[model samples]
Target: MSKFIPLSVPNLKGNELKYVTKAVETEWVSTGGPYVNDFEKNVAEYVKAKGAVSCQNGTSGLHIALLLCGVTRDDEVIVPTLTFIAAVNPVRYIGAEPIFMDCDDSLTMDADKLDEFCREECILIDGKLISHKTNKHIKVVLVVHVFGNMADMERIMQIAKQYNLIVVEDATEAIGTYYTKGKYNGKFAGTIGTIGVFSFNGNKIITTGGGGMIVSEDKELLKKAKHLTTQAKSDELYYTHDEIGYNYRMTNLQAALGLAQLEQLEGFIKTKEENYNLYRNKIQEIKGLTILDFRADIRSNHWFYALHCDENYPLSRDEIIRYLALKGIQSRPIWGLINDQEPYIGSQVYKIEKAKYFWERVVNIPCSTNLTKKDALYVIECLKNAV
Candidate 1:
């Protein structure tokens, strides 16, 4: 047995080598090239977005989106404490503070709690959502569609519109997910907000070695993101700079890989969903161990398979992770609650009840596109016997 049933990994069985080799042969290995533009176009079309801009990684894309949304030092951005730190770090980068919130049953931002948070603790100061505890103006709500399940975006957007706040979606783990029944019926994850970001890291569904993309419906917003990602250069040849910017551009080589990966996005998503179904049918029979549920209102890509430990569960999440580790399986605990982390200890957070509950009990199992039926059965057999 090898200790390498990974939680996630890139699929390079498509046109990766051919395109990357072509880029190398053409001497377009650096940031500027045709593939970069083409990759952006493919993603924008895939997600049904107005436009897209590629960047160095998801974090930089998020920072640029925050800048475009006017997030400043005195501003507060609402975020989920249960999400990966990368989703919230951009709020701090803009000199803005993060106000950690709770998650719902879907493990996404708690939409119901959001309105309650605003009604109880927030005050409208000259048309701003102001927090009395931190004395910061809450300017944006950064909602994450955790593990590819669609967040309750329709309600969240309505709340944003009423509160005079911008909604920035961190759909890094949920590129293909979208609403199926709500006001945003046909909208894709990243396409519904003021701005959205996606990742192409090694462990994502697809990869460009390492890169990201940002999208927005507004042409001006997309333009600003494109300019800022390339160091905010006003002049291309002379390279004159005005405002502070980031060297967050993705290379042509990476874009070439992304272009190849985009061609398989649909197939990758389909396989992932199929794997999730096998896990669910098997795991559901065992009490205290239940597979995550995708919302019926949305068609999920099932990016990750997280098991919730009920009272009858044979072990705690940590115990299960250790058991799987001993059996040469790779599983993971959810991110440590952000509000509980050392750096954000003093930051303001709403009553994050659900997020706190989930942080301790969730264990993410192997869910990769490359997982074969044999591999899935192997995992299920181990899980059934482990308990």
Candidate 2:
């Protein structure tokens, strides 16, 4: 049997072993260590954020970020329907419901639809935007940068500002992506909103095995996020509890791996971009399928590459995935629309047009940073033959 080309996997060829070994030798494998602080510092500098706080995982970071945003029971957070369930689960963790929104061509949240929803389906009362359907206070817009493709943050931010909504960018899949044009030119994905969270899960651009980081321009909010994630202890020596908190701090071992991954992030991104372009060039002429691109105005990390299969395709999305698996290649369809999920069936969804379209058509292909040119070509050839 031939070697399997995975959909996405960790590329840990950097100093991962050395750092992790050192952490183990120093007996700092737990949540507290110098590597943890160093990892946070390196990530903050890389993403150009004022501060970053390390957490157990992206979901926890999101939970704390939403908490800091003051999301309470009966509050609604606007979220994209075309993302991993983890992006929306944090809203429920805070006792808040999610209002699922659709995606645009780029597979990110549609800022136009968001604006329309706010203007027509909601009303501002005493400086608070209340949803007409459930009468819940709409507090945050949880925008996930799907597959490293950024949403229209400029327009989204404008609508959010006009409606007094806090924007929480769920950048779990977009660590190195940044805009190159417009109001947030040179701004990273997770740093532009009210607060942003990045995941370093095994499948992400960079992996800490399982970890996440929270970033914000506001120092106070960043500090508060740190506090909440660290058990909300008002006094370190006395261990005085100010309020409820969570043990969401990232472990030193995870930070050790993360620090090494951070060092090679730019290089990994370059490789991902090159491979994506290779896939684009090779697959563009294929009938019945199209490889999606990142936003033109941004230098995206080019994380996961989605192949949009139209009706002209010879096989369905699931069929293609199965074929790829038989050929020792891994592929997957996009996430099921969040609104349709069993837990969120009762939640509100606004004119979910494009999200459902993309969900049915989009198939993620092999896009690991270490994927060689030959591997990419093989994937393209196999996919073409399968169709």
Candidate 3:
């Protein structure tokens, strides 16, 4: 009980040290090495992607994906306001603006609102969907799978196709999540979009310290992503530069750790799913509080457990977080709506009602892969007795 229980942390009990040690011994710890290529291949094969490219981090991957989608300075992307700020920052990285959208009960982008915006607020001219208000081309729909929960891809895809918009899936928190039924049955979260990005941050299901991968079904686009991430070396021997590029390639050391983490990903997901169910059953018995559930149609990674506190709850969301902190348990409130943040003020926003509702009530509890059952029980106990 004295030990501090964290919200999420890496479980590096596998071959991480072994692979990383090997990389160091071989002096292939920088951007170029065998481990980098192996890690990319393993991830692409796991996600059923045509090809994968390694990048410095998820934000960089998203920036590259936006470029590949042809989103320019004259364009705007539709994004969810409820997600982490990293998901929306890439829109501005390319000089494009973001049109924030609301979230549904599942805490993902509301596909219905997206369709409404495109239909009633935009004009399609020669296959280009242009916003009537800003006169900017709406070229991309960037959807984030928040907390490993899959977004409503089926309806979103239909809307994207109708409006000639590119779909980019930010699967940073959903490395192993996939659909089990409907159109995308048997398909992974990142594979369903034109371009998908995955993160290997320390707190993700798996960790490479800090790294990311870009996946796509388009072979040419995948090749271009690799080129753009690697400084666009048309001639590597001569260091010839053709266009603007980023030094966003992942290091061999990070990839080595990533390869090891990827090997144990399925086992980590199993533990996460089991812990999620445990929290769900126990939280239901607590008055005025309950654990949020993932979609019934998909197999989710359950990366973080959301504890929803209602008006009837004994304590407010922030109150519960403070109480848990005093109890030596780490709990955090869900991110503030990105549209309301300082950088995004005055940016276009669709119906943003539901996002604020969830933001004021949701608390992320301890659901790390390394979290013990005793720790989870202790967390729930603290929540139940909070006054």
Best by lDDT: 3
C-alpha lDDT values of all predictions? 0.89, 0.92, 0.94
- Model 1, C-alpha of 162: deviation from truth (Å): 0.9
Worst 10 residues of 1 by lDDT: 1-10
TM-score per prediction, in order, is 0.98, 0.98, 0.99
Question: Order the candidates by lDDT, highest first — what do you get?
Answer: 3, 2, 1
**Residue lDDT tens for model 2, 1-387:** 768988889998999999999999999999899999999999999989999999999999999999999999878899999899999898888788899898899999998899999999999999999999888899999999999989899999999999999999999999999999999999999998989999999999999999999999999998899889999999989999899989999999999999999999999999999998898988888898889988999999999999988988898888988888998998999999989999999788999999888888889999998899999999899878875
Whole-model lDDT, candidate 1?
A: 0.89
Q: Which candidate model has the greater lDDT, 2 or 3?
A: 3
lDDT minimum window of 10 residues, candidate 3 = 378-387
Off by over 4 Å in 1: none
lDDT tens readout by residue for model 1, 144-165: 9899998898899999998988
Name the top TM-score candidate. Answer: 3
Candidate 3: count of backbone clashes, pairs at least 3 residues apart or interchain = 0
User: Which one wins by TM-score: 2 or 3?
Assistant: 3
When sorted by TM-score, best at the front, the candidate numbers are 3, 2, 1
lDDT of 2 at 307: 93
